[model samples]
Target chain A: MVRAEGLTFYYERLDEEGNVESKKRAVDHVDLHIRPGKFIAILGHNGSGKSTLAKHINAILTPAEGTLWVDGMDTKEEEKLWDIRQDAGMVFQNPDNQIIGTVVEEDVGFGPENLGVPTDEIWKRVEESLDAVGMLKYRHHSPNKLSGGQKQRVAIAGVMAMHPRCIVLDEPTAMLDPNGRKSVIQTAQRLNREEGITIILITHYMEEVVEADHVFVMDEGRVVMEGSPRQVFSQVEELKKLRLDVPQATLLAFELQKRGVRLPDGILRNEELVDELCRLKSKM
Target chain B: MSIKVKNVNYTYAEGTAYEIHALKDINLEIPDGQFIGLIGHTGSGKSTLVQHLNGLVKATSGRIYFNERDIYGENFSMKELRSKVGLVFQYPEHQLFEVDVLSDVCFGPRNLGCSQAEAEKKAREALHMVGLGAEYEKRSPFELSGGQKRRVAIAGVLAMEPQVLILDEPTAGLDPKGRDEILDQIESLQKERGITVVLVSHSMEDVARYVDRIIVMDHGEVRFDGTPKEVFRHYKELEKMGLAAPQMTYLMQGLREKGADVDADATTIEEAADAVEHWLKSK
Candidate 1:
């Protein structure tokens, strides 16, 4: 379980007069909780503090005020920082920046190696991680020659080898192509369903959020909304006013409703909208 | 102007021990005034292909023709090609190094040997083209937001007055609103300026929405070349290649497979909805 209560963070920004500003709160008095074994997607515009929240989960940055607890372990404890990071692995945006070793397998093993897993165990972890992401065939291949999705999978494998209970992906698909995005999402979903690991996906893409179990919407460094996919998407205009937009299917449904289609609210997927339309027709 | 690459083959670090077959014996033609979308997984030679258009990379074998003239000759004026075909690299904003936005935009045209006044004028015009106002002229490029800085970078390229503008993932890091703004601006430029556009993107959805034609690449080969609708219609092959149909396409197809009357070939969410409504009424 993950719990954050009244969390606040600040960064200093200088003013026009060259005097240091008091503080800029990247996240302010935010309270949130993620139950174990659920796919939670975090949606926010750029610089809206979703990434800040993500960094908190992996203990990369501790809260300046309030508290955060991951699996009942206090994030403020410096001694447990490494374990916290291992418990909640992070996959950053740039896949190129994450992968270090020359060979794919060797690079994946680097994470476990740093965690002090033995040489043989590192290989075992590497194989398993690669298999999880479906990149085991490219184990011996050089990373420089791999596609963006393949490279990202290798990055995920690096994180997976650590055997974290939760994976926090911060705009991981932003730098990838459509193909890369699909493979990465599928792998993350599989890991969540098959391995029972929790996924905290931070992204701007609306479509990516459609499959998520629960979602939190952020604006101006605070959690303004949280609900299932249907609940969040149902508030189309509210999201739009916050500089956030719905998936194309959701928007089209909203438009259809506007045109007096008599569709129900909170249709998240095209199939649901399709099924609803068919039902309306049958009833008519 | 048109660009034609015939039997092009290249390898990175060819003579050295670390060689990569970046491109195979490729043949393709980019017609004048056509908006072409290029898609590939990383290392699929899409970047390599665009680089050849503006003479950024030389083919190790075969020929490249610009209109009726062969451009791969030894005496090629890469300088001229740079003028005719402008390439906006990924995160083009990060390449902005000048102190002021105006100076930054002028750098490209000035380097191309335009008079200082001419370059400045073109720079201002280009800035306006990307929707920047007069007040933004004095601000540092570094001070701008990610989306604004990207437009500035594109303006810098526009100042060079290229016949074809090649954008590589121009909307990569943008939010939805920002992405639409950029894509809409690109579409307007293509229509108003009538410049051939080569859009290098990974998002099939973005390509499906904005571009007229699509080229799919894999392992240094052109796997599929067609209109966006035609390309996305092959859903199984696309998935097998580690690619995804646009979200709406996938959903529509999945529902169709499950015996729903939704048109599986809808390429956009809006189109998918229209197809559904039509089918519903007909039923």
Candidate 2:
């Protein structure tokens, strides 16, 4: 589990004189608690500080004015930075930037190797991790030659090899196609379900968010709304005002509701909407 | 310009130890001003085929013609071909290194020997085409949001005023709003400028919704090419190739199997809605 209290981050800009000319808070007065073993989706428009919040979960960016703890380890402690990162692995948006190893299997093993895991066990972890992300078939191939989706899966496998209790994926599917996106989401879910690792998926795709047990909506560097996906997406107007869109089916269903059709709220999938319409027609 | 590719065969690093038959005996014709959606799983030779369109890469065998002129044939300058077929690579931002957004966008036009002022004007217009404003010109590319930075990179290619624009996953690494904006801009560009468009994407739903024609590739060969409905009709085979049919198409197919009188060819939500409504009214 993770906890934050009044966390704030400032990006300090200095003039030529070496004095801080100004400071802009990227994350402002944010309080959060991520329960262990839950698949949570964080939704926000760009520059909403969601990425900043994700960084805090893994101690990538320590809080400037507040406190954060990962699994009871304070992130502010210098020695705990590595421990924090080990406890909650971070997967960034760009797979090309994170992958250092030339070969696929080697890339996945780099994390465990860096952690001083035994050589025999490192390969085992690497294989398991790659298999988890469906990248094992490409284990012998070069990372540079892989597709965006494959490379990202390798990145996830690299993080998985670290054996973190939780994985913080910052826009993991942003660069992927719909197939890649689905695979990545399914992998994250599998990790959460099978491996019992906590998952924090930060993305802007409303359809992907529908499957999450908990959803947090952020705007202007604050957690503006937090609830289940149905609870969050049911309020279509508020999401729209926040510059976010509901799932397409949900939006269409909402539009139909406004047109005097009594469809249910928070229709996540097209099948659900179709089924609802079919039932309505049966009554006639 | 129309492109006719006949039995094109290409291999990366051919004769070398790492030679990959990235493309094989592929033949296709891109009619003038046609909007083509190129879809495939990873390593399906989609990238290889696009490179041949603008002469970025020569086919190991076979010939490419642009309106009866051989692509590799004399009298067809590679520079002219490049200017005609503008390719925006997948990670376009990797190529940007100028001091400001304006300078970055002008890089392509300036390289083509346009005057500084002319390149700057082209940059401005290109930025506008991608929905960026003149105010973006002064800002540092790194300081802007990722989506904004991507638009600047796209504008750099658009500034060349290419007749045939090819985009490789232009909406990659963007949010939904950003994706919608980019797709809308591409759609408008195809309509307003009447430019030939080749959109390379992995999203079956997006391609099914927008593209006039869909080309499916598998293992470095053209597996299928036709309208979206025609390609998606082989839903089982596409799935076997690690691809998915569009959601609406899948839904309609499932409904028909469930005996719900839905049209399997309905690809978009609007079309599906209309089809379902019509079916319901008939019932």
Question: Which candidate wins on DockQ?
Answer: 1
Off by over 4 Å in 1: A14-23, A118-123, B13-21, B251-265
Clashes of each: 1, 0
| DockQ of all candidate complexes | 0.52, 0.40
**Candidate 1, DockQ score (0 to 1):** 0.52
Error of 1 at B196 (Å): 1.6
Interface RMSD of each: 2.2, 2.5
Against the reference, the lDDT scores of all candidates come to 0.88, 0.87
What interface-residue Cα RMSD does candidate 1 give after superposition? 2.2
* Cα lDDT tens digits for candidate 1, A114-216: 9999999998999999999999999999998787788888999999999999999988899887778888899999999999999999888898899999999
lDDT of 2 by residue, A1-284 (tens): 99999999998989999999999888999998889999999999878889988988988789998899999999999988877888899898888899999899998999989899999999999999998988888999999988777888899999999999999999887767556778888989899999999999998777788889899898888999999998999999998878788886787677667656678887888778878878876776
lDDT string for model 1 (B193-233, tens) is 89889999877778988888998888888899899889998
